[model samples]
Target: MSENARVTKAAGVVGAATFLSRIFGFVRDVVIAWFFGAGLSSDAFFVAFRIPNLLRRLFAEGSLSIAFIPVFTEYLTHHGKEEAFHLARSAMRLLSIILVITAVLGVLLAPLIILMIAPGFTDSPEKYSLTVLLTRIMFPYIFFICLVALCMGILNVLGHFAAPALAPVCLNIAIIFSAFFISPYMADPVTGLAIGVLIGGALQLTLQLPFLIRKGFYFWEKAVIFHPGVKKIGILMLPAIFGASVYQLNILVGTLLASLLPEGSVSYLYYADRLVQFPLGIFAIATATAVLPSLSRQAAAKDFDALGNTFAHAMKLVFFITVPSMAGLI
Candidate 1:
């Protein structure tokens, strides 16, 4: 198929899968509201979840995928599949070690982190303690989800979009299952949601593994610790990480201010943000995800004309969908 057609087809697949995930996510939110309402537990859960969720976006899905894909695609286009796979394996090994250490530190520093993000929680000792506990419980999710993100980058480079796009549906399903099945039995019902986050992250990583293995990308293979591609990815990732961090810091500031508001203010903001994210995730992110591999290949091939056309096509598609959605929201 042609490049434009390929991009469109991939975007459609991703958008459809994201639509399903968002629907499930909406249901999950409704279940949470029904079970916990928008008070202390809900507020605490949102704050705790936000910390790791922010890190996930910053380090894993956003920066890591953005950096890894171009480099991985270049390796595939120029070097060969074997070289690309080696780079992926090397990245997987190194990332796993870093994520393990980060998770451990996040768990240990949950109190300090929570204090920095939501100082007003200190006013309510119970809320503060619960948020810290939940944060600790969910910190390990970062490890699983980041691995999933790496798998996603590799798969996308290999021309597989459906599995990666559908992975998030697993998360919403896990959370919904926890709300109905697990929370009732827990001493603190909100703790179940935290458990759900971990389960969802693991499930996402698990969902990607069979696909990766089928494509000959095995995690168990010996990896090069200091691969040159890994260094290049690291270099590309640093700036992206910084940009995401700045955006997240803005979010953290908002969360901090929200924590100081009325009891349900945090939950209110969280719900509104989710609503806004629905359209953005479905079209905007899907389009970008679909085009990345194509753009990377064109650049690798030094096909500047093709690259310009592909970039323009993606921009037009994004504007077509997002403009109307934004107007409707307004």
Candidate 2:
């Protein structure tokens, strides 16, 4: 098969899996809507969920995957598997340590974080406190997700797209189960949703583990905080982080504005955004995830022609797939 044909097939595989996952995600949201409806409790949960969800996808699915693949591909192509595995280990270990610290800080500072994030809730201490409580419960999810993102980066480089793409389906399934079976038992339905997040995060991580192991992923027992490859990834990540933050920044702005409106405005926007995410997650992200490794390999080979061709192919695919969805949403 032609290189372009091979790349297209991989993208198709990723897109198909991602599409399924997004469908389940929509179902999960429907379950949430049925049980929680739109109210102060739902608003609090949305605010709490939104902050971490933004960071989770940005780091795990967006910036981290984009940054890691090129450097990792270079290591694999030039330095051999052992050296590449060292790079992966170093990066994952450092990422793990950082996520743990961040999660801890997020929990400890939940009240202050809530004040800054959703200040409008201050007038209603119950809503404000519930947001804080849920935020803390969900903060540790950052740790599980960072590992999942790193695993996803590794798997994508190895041409293992299906498992990583389908991993998110586990998260949706966990949430759906919680909403239907667990939420009814909780005094606050949102608590059940919060617990589901932790469960889903673990499921996301665990689902990718065996695949990663099969790819001969070498995980370091100790953190290598200062590896050169990790440094390279960090340098690449800084600008990509800003670039990725555009979407999150928009959400932050929207949430700030939404908090000032009627009590349930945040919940309404949250529901709408979930619908928007369906296509964004399925098409745009799948293309990005599929294209990055191919681009990285071509760039590492110093084949500018193939590199340009791959990018062009990706752009065309993304444009054709997303334009209709964008129009429909509008």
Candidate 3:
């Protein structure tokens, strides 16, 4: 298949998967709203979810995947699969250590984080405590989701899109199930949502594993502590984190401000943001995800012309789809 056709087809797969995920996500939101309403519980849950979700966007999906893909693709193109797989293992090891530390710290610092992000919650001691508890429960989600992001980068480089694209659907379904089946039994019903986040994250990671192993990317091997490709990914990730997460930072700021508003303000903004993310995820993100491996390979081969063409094609496709979606939303 031609490069353009390959990218277009991959995008279609990812977009379709993302569309399904978004639909389930909407249903998840509805279930939460039906049970919790836009009150203290809902607001607390949203704020709790937002902290880890922001980190997932900023570090996992935004930085790690973006930085890991090109480097991993380059390893595959020039150095061969064995060496590339070595780098993948090394990256996973380092990421696991870092994520473990981060999750631990996040749990310990949940109160301080909640204070910084939603100071107004302090006005209601109950809300503040609940948010802190929920935040701690969901903080570990960052660990699982980031690993899933690394798996996504590897799989996408290996020409697999469906599993990673379908990952979010697992999260949505998990949350919906928890809302219905688990929340009723919980002492604090909203606590179930936090547990769902962790379960969803684990399911996302689990879904990628069999596909990865089938492609000969197993996790059982000992990892190099200082692989060169891992170093390069780290270097690339610093800039990528800031570059890709400016919008997320804006949302974080919005979340902080929303905390100062009425009781339901945070939940209101969360729902609205979900509506906007639906189209963006299905089109813009899918196109970028599909194009990355191709662009990376072309660049690795020093095929500048092909790289430029692929980039241009992706940009045009994103605009063609997203502009109309944007207009409709407006």
lDDT of 3 by residue, 156-195 (tens): 9999999999999999999999998889999999999899
RMSD of each: 0.8, 1.4, 0.8
Residue-level lDDT of model 1, residues 1-330, one tens digit each, is: 989999999999999999999999999999999998899999999999998899899999769999999999999988998889999999999999999999999999999999999999999999999999999999999999999999999999899999999999999999999998899999999999999998999999999999999999877787787899999999999999988898788889999999999898899999999999999999999999999999999999999999999999999999999999999999
| Per-residue lDDT of candidate 2, residues 94-171 (tens digit) | 888899999999999999988887888888988998999999999998898888888888988988989988988998
- Reference-based TM-score, model 1: 0.99
| Per-prediction TM-score | 0.99, 0.96, 0.99
lDDT-based ranking: 1, 3, 2
Worst lDDT 10-window in candidate 1: 217-226
Query: CA shift at 148, candidate 3, in angstroms?
Result: 0.1
Query: Which of candidates 1 and 2 is the stronger one according to TM-score?
Result: 1
Candidate 2 contains a number of clashing pairs equal to 0
Q: Deviation in angstroms for 118 in model 3?
A: 0.3
Q: lDDT for every model? A: 0.94, 0.87, 0.94
Where in model 3 is the C-alpha error above 4 Å?
A: none
